[model samples]
Target chain A: MTAWKEIDQHVKVWMNYARKLILAQIKTDVQVSTKSGPNDLVTNVDKEIEEYYVKQIKLFFPNSLILGEEGHKDSGMLKHQGYFWVIDPIDGTMNFVKEQENFASMIAIYYNGKPLLGYIYDVMKDKLFWGGPACQAVYCNNEKLNSPANLSLKDGLFGASCPMVLRNYRGINEVISKSSGARIVGSAGIEFINVMSGKLCAYLSFLRPWDYLPGKILAETLGLIVKTIDGEPVNVLSSTDVLVATDNAQSEIFKIINNY
Target chain B: MTAWKEIDQHVKVWMNYARKLILAQIKTDVQVSTKSGPNDLVTNVDKEIEEYYVKQIKLFFPNSLILGEEGHKDSGMLKHQGYFWVIDPIDGTMNFVKEQENFASMIAIYYNGKPLLGYIYDVMKDKLFWGGPACQAVYCNNEKLNSPANLSLKDGLFGASCPMVLRNYRGINEVISKSSGARIVGSAGIEFINVMSGKLCAYLSFLRPWDYLPGKILAETLGLIVKTIDGEPVNVLSSTDVLVATDNAQSEIFKIINNY
Candidate 1:
């Protein structure tokens, strides 16, 4: 098998193992803690899942570097050659803690600074959306996903960040008013799935590296556009307002944002 | 069996049958149509599901009056001193047509102008949230659901209508800013499930009787508050801005709306 195919198999196995760890503890009492502020929650499951990924990556591929959501970081991984992985084990910690649904676990792999493989596991739904430029197509489990319809903003539901919509940040409210409607599922991974699946035309939010990268790789592979709100390329390591959308919606949203 | 118990059983069986009809047709080409506007969608599956429920209700309880989302209405049934049923063959028509997920089928039963039973089946998830004052407890399938904690405005997530949040209707933006965050799922039945399950502290939307009745019945039965934004009694036969929330969140939201 090709190296990419072998790595893909390993990542899927690790993700499913991480999924079990999360589901096993979800029904029991979750040890909840706050990060940054009261509303920014992180549970014990998130930490354990991330730790498990970090350990597995190290065990399976000793040369690979890692960046993880729960404080696992390799300071100079980006500069190194070979495998570099980004892990968001239990994205949407708030949803995981409160609803135990609508959350996901994700991994994005880059080889020598090129996007290679991505995996996003909708933990509750048990749907794994994985693939990248290397694999040449994205999949929701065993089914390969066709590119979503090229819908404009007005033709599809828009997914907005709560803070952006609430504060009318950059005139997002104006943009929302022009769409069919808005949906805020509160999990970036789920929102990404919506855009990739043609359920939503676009999703815009302030997202950190781990929050946006896996979805970015998969979405772009499916012929969707992933970029900064300003229509510039997104910095893979920085937190910024990222927008993943159909080509038509990206142009429409850019028009609104530039007008704002 | 008691009359109410028998009715509940019948409704459950009928809802499951409706669910099957919906699932079977969901993957095939859905015959799409519209009502009121382009965004207001209805599919042949929706019509089929409602027709099935209406037929069953008429067959089993010949005296029961029916009001359905897809043009099945029995005028003056509110005045009848017997069972009155409201059916939304498929809630979240847009979601159903676009995402094929996050939508539901619902039924609300009233006796002598008083709410009796409510069932909201999340078709894609295969989970039915059903119960009423008659049952004395709410259930997700077979397990009984406990009342969600009475979280205050800042302690929980807030669910808002896209238009309401966009227009800042009655200062809903202010209320959203005070909560942990805002979520807009665009389906009243799904949002009601979130609030009833304590995933959200509140959900506010302008809904028709068929849109809100089933959820209002289930929510109120679970020790949650269901009322108009102004704290007035929700008229069961009219369209209005309804709020379903925990006690503390309701009071906090009412204060904000009143000030607005």
Candidate 2:
């Protein structure tokens, strides 16, 4: 228990530190460029923030394994004991570089393949969603999470990847046309906040491990569905097309996405 | 000039009033229900606010036509000599009902088929994007508008409806996959904020007049392309697929969508 508390405290400190550094860079003229194409933007802030977290991780917890989005440590090993830290120093890099609002910093800690901690920080909003399976508390900043009002896709909003909608993403169009309507917030971190806050009925994305790990921890803690679209158990180490929804909402989404 | 200034003042005053009332309704346990489905939602606040805006519009400008999301007015005839007020009293209704954070109240005024005024109030953020073709001054709260850095889709981020990319609405997927990245914030008003702030290269959605009307006014004022998917003028009284982008970005998007 003390170790858990220690880990949480240590992580909290690092997150605040990273947040300060990142926002400072964003407020300045940081050099920006493209990765895959015109829309996929990356900035020096993403790299600098990640390196800051990694340096702290190595110094305080040398035994812990690190996996990050910037391709810093490609040791290519997910299986670890003691502790493993999966980090996206800037989870929504495009949003961070572009919107400067919706992006997040995500970090998840696992012990012996058991989820222990997750944190998704929205810098612009100044909100932090933090928790784990072992901890009974999932918090937004200092406030405890109130379980989202029970709602289904037909009754609530869906957070979806825009590209998926056009490809007939297995009834996604139908989902939007049928639902109150669809909303597309650009960042996974913001989407996770919406889900945990019970704003969106569900959020599904072509997501990577670091992109979702922290959100998965928070969502699961708040009693939301965190799984692959096919209803398979999520393998946190891989990038999976995942859905995070309320229990009742999951069934409705499943019926829709499957038919699409 | 007197008429424009008076109406602009009226817009700002009523926008603030609507913002407060909407926020108050959010804090209250207002009634909420599904619209088309769970993804689509409506609260009593959305309805009341629209009614309130219409009342204000008809009171001040008795002959002005009104278009709203809650089916408030008839925009069938937007003739010359008077004004047409396009209002989405509470944009991002789902967010207002569910998360209560990401919504906005948008208003746009046009006269003789030309944009006269535009305002998108980020109630939660307390920031307002306001200007018009006649005003030629875009302000967020009190800050004056400056020409944004000219960036292409490849050099910037984009906002699209989540489901639009999957089924190939104008080859959005190929365009998105090749660009910096995509973000889908569920609200057109909010997405319009991204474009006006110069964060997004573009935002494309199948939107009605109320949905894209204010957005078109602001996007145009900010030197962004807000047009129909095909090469035609956006009919402010009709629901259509609208694209708001930078010049070069729009050309790239046009090429891609046309190809698809």
TM-score of each: 0.97, 0.87
Q: Which ten residues in a row have the lowest lDDT in candidate 2 chain B?
A: B162-171
Evaluate fnat for each of the predicted models and list the values in order: 0.77, 0.79
Q: Name the best candidate (by DockQ).
A: 1
Kindly provide the TM-score of model 1 when superposed on the true structure, using C-alpha atoms.
Answer: 0.97
- Alpha carbon lDDT of each predicted model: 0.91, 0.79
Candidate 1 residue lDDT tens string, B165-192: 8788989999988898898888999999
Docking class of 2: medium
- The candidates' DockQ values read 0.78, 0.50
Runs with alpha carbons beyond 4 Å of true place in candidate 2: A33-42, A72-81, A162-181, A252-260, B1-3, B33-42, B58-65, B71-77, B111-114, B162-167, B170-174
Local accuracy of candidate 2 as per-residue lDDT tens digits, A1-260: 23788888888899899888887788676787767765465678778878888899889888878888877664534566567788888876766766677788889888877788899988888888998786777988888887887786667777877666646566667766655556766678778888888778888888888888888888888888899888898987887888888898788777876776
Model 1 chain B: worst 10 consecutive residues (lDDT sum):
B1-10
Best by lDDT: 1
Two-chain DockQ for model 2: 0.50
Model 1 lDDT per residue over A1-260, tens place: 13998888888898889888888899895899999988789988888889999999899888888999999999787787888999999889988887889899999999888899888899998999999999899999999999999998888999889888878889888888888889988889999999999999999999999999999999999999999999999988999999999999999999998998
